[model samples]
Target: MPSRTSRPTRRTALLCAAGLLALPRLQAAPAKKPLPPPPDVWPRPALVPGGVARLSLGPSATRPQAHSGELPLLVVGDAIEWTALVGIALAAPPGEAAITVAAPGEAARRVPYRIVAKKYQEQRLTVSPRTVDLSSEDQARYEREREHLAGVMATFSPAVPAQLHMQVPVPGRRSSSFGLRRIFNGQARNPHSGMDIAAATGTPVRAPLDGRVVDVGDYFFNGGTVWLDHGAGLLSMYCHLSAMDVKPGDQLRAGDAFCKVGATGRVTGPHLHWSVMLNRAMVDPALFIDA
Candidate 1:
């Protein structure tokens, strides 16, 4: 009996094809960049508002989780020595508050802490009537943009941030206008949620730390805006930008130029409105900036 002619097996053919594909890929692949070093852990204060408080997770082999008033907090370090980054809201009442810390296979524990009252200054400014009172059409547009921005600010990515010590995005004098209750044209508005840096138009705005660009768009109030997610519910926003160098999904490293300062939105001059968000709450930018 004549034996059937030998044939190349499917598995053997697949191996040859895979080897051919890998050869070109290995030759053309670019060198991988080294990651930035982790940031130094800042000292956690006891009474926190514009600061962060640390909560001990105790001795355990498993990593722990934390929360402050229903808002999930940032937990860093290992099991043997874990600390919860409790971000106290600017409007958080100055009184007894508790943080819930839980570890795997253990009951959740509440760490009681107090928040001290911090008095913010008042600023009265009489801007143009159009800015204070938007027209019906502009108001509708502003509302729509507001909703869009709220979604951007609420982004929480799983990527853990490397450096927490952030550089000032733009080189200028950081105005003491943060958290100011402003009277715009005799109409009181929400307190200022960001730090205003006085800078000339076209000044290059750099990324304070490594992060991914989550959103970029021109808003009614924010004008040309860019939102960066530094991971673990830590977000940063740059408003009134003249131009953007990156878009959503773009990853940037510390000191990378990402935007330019401008008077694009509702602003009195060319400057940058930088806001830092922790656990979706807009906190003082001074909390993260080193210089």
Candidate 2:
């Protein structure tokens, strides 16, 4: 029997404490992780063809490298959180798509995302029969230009542009929207890959963002074209210009007039055709501009 007022012996107390330790203990549920805030910038996420997808890659000590297929993607942000801006091709099928992320000292992993379908409007126009049915000489010239433009489009510099939003180059009514299919003289042609702005022949065309002139040429189809490399995998093209003020390797700031509107190429009238390319994909330029 134990006395009510007597203290337990040291050995008994120790044994009791040990027994208590052996019993199951309750733990507070792990604190819920806070959700990340939405990105407050241009080029908002649109998980569809011809759209830009913003993928969040968890924190890393160094900038992680990401790629969509073989082409490297543009990864931005700091050590706390990095994000990959993936440009979905207009021809990309609506289904599961993934990008490869490689962080320093870690095995590369695949980050998967989904692409939904989108439909664009169709347009038909009447142009010269000769423009639709090209001559042999003109066809050869077009092939050469196409091959050269492919190399220009593949330009990728190390520095990424600080600003993503672009200003309208030539302020006017939007003549044609992007991804518009066209029927020229009853012959089906490729979908319009750019946003066309209706302006006068001498209307000054300005740079939408800071970039370096990569290629300046008078293409058969594009005409007095100027390609600006905006660093990383982003590039912009201004076509059908009456005059080009900037040459290759020239640096241009936003709002600087680099060319003038014209009907130099195969067109019905004077207009500026602006195209934005990312990761070798011609995405909708409207994505990088304000409505």
Candidate 1 residue lDDT tens string, 126-234: 6668887899998999999888877886787766677677888988887645688888888889888889999999999999989999999998878899999988888
* Model 2 score (lDDT): 0.92
User: Candidate 2, 179: how far from true, in Å?
Assistant: 0.6
How high is the CA lDDT of each candidate model?
0.81, 0.92
What TM-score do all the candidates reach, one by one?
Answer: 0.81, 0.86
lDDT of 1 at 82: 82
Each prediction's RMSD to truth: 20.8, 9.3
The 10-residue segment of model 2 with minimum total lDDT is 2-11
**Model 1 alpha-carbon miss at residue 1, Å:** 99
Instruction: Identify the candidate with maximal lDDT.
Output: 2
Per-residue CA lDDT of model 2 for 1-291, tens digit only, reads 867545567668889999999999899999999999966667878888888999999999999999998998888889999999999988899999999999989999999999999998988899888788999999999999999998999999989888899999999999999989899999988888999999999999999999999999999888889999998999999999999998899999999998999998889999999999999998899999987
Model 1 ranges with Cα > 4 A deviation: 1-40, 43-48
TM-score of 1: 0.81
